[model samples]
Target: MFPPLCCDSGVDQASRRRHHQSRKMAMLSFWRDGLERQLAAVTAAMDTLQRQIDRDAQSDS
Candidate 1:
């Protein structure tokens, strides 16, 4: 689901751990960005609904 992580040419365990951590961090970042975007969209929608309700109530006066 993501581009490959940058990895060292060495085959030692530390290099492998670095590569794993890099990939994990990348995935987390991606997920966080997506969640934040969705939250913003929901918040905007709620604000719009509230405005419409308020406007309608005022018009009834």
Candidate 2:
């Protein structure tokens, strides 16, 4: 009975570790996706501003 209990404990610990790892991976993916989206938005805004600046300079010339 004692040996069986030890084996069971090991199995439970392994399963818990896997669960924690999966959760960490999920959170990392979520943050990464959010960062990518924000970066894309910033880049698009920059492009628009740059284009406007160019247009303004050309008009002045």
Per-residue CA lDDT of model 2 for 1-61, tens digit only, reads 0122234454677786676688889999999999999999999999999999999999999
**Which 10-residue span in candidate 2 carries the lowest summed lDDT?**
1-10
List TM-scores for all candidates, in order.
Answer: 0.78, 0.75
Q: Look at candidate 2 and give me any clashing residue pairs.
A: none
Best by TM-score: 1
Model 1 stretches astray by more than 4 angstroms: 1-10
lDDT of 1 by residue, 8-48 (tens): 46677777768778889999999999999999999999999
Error of 2 at 19 (Å): 1.2
Task: Look at candidate 2 and tell me the lDDT of residue 28.
Answer: 90
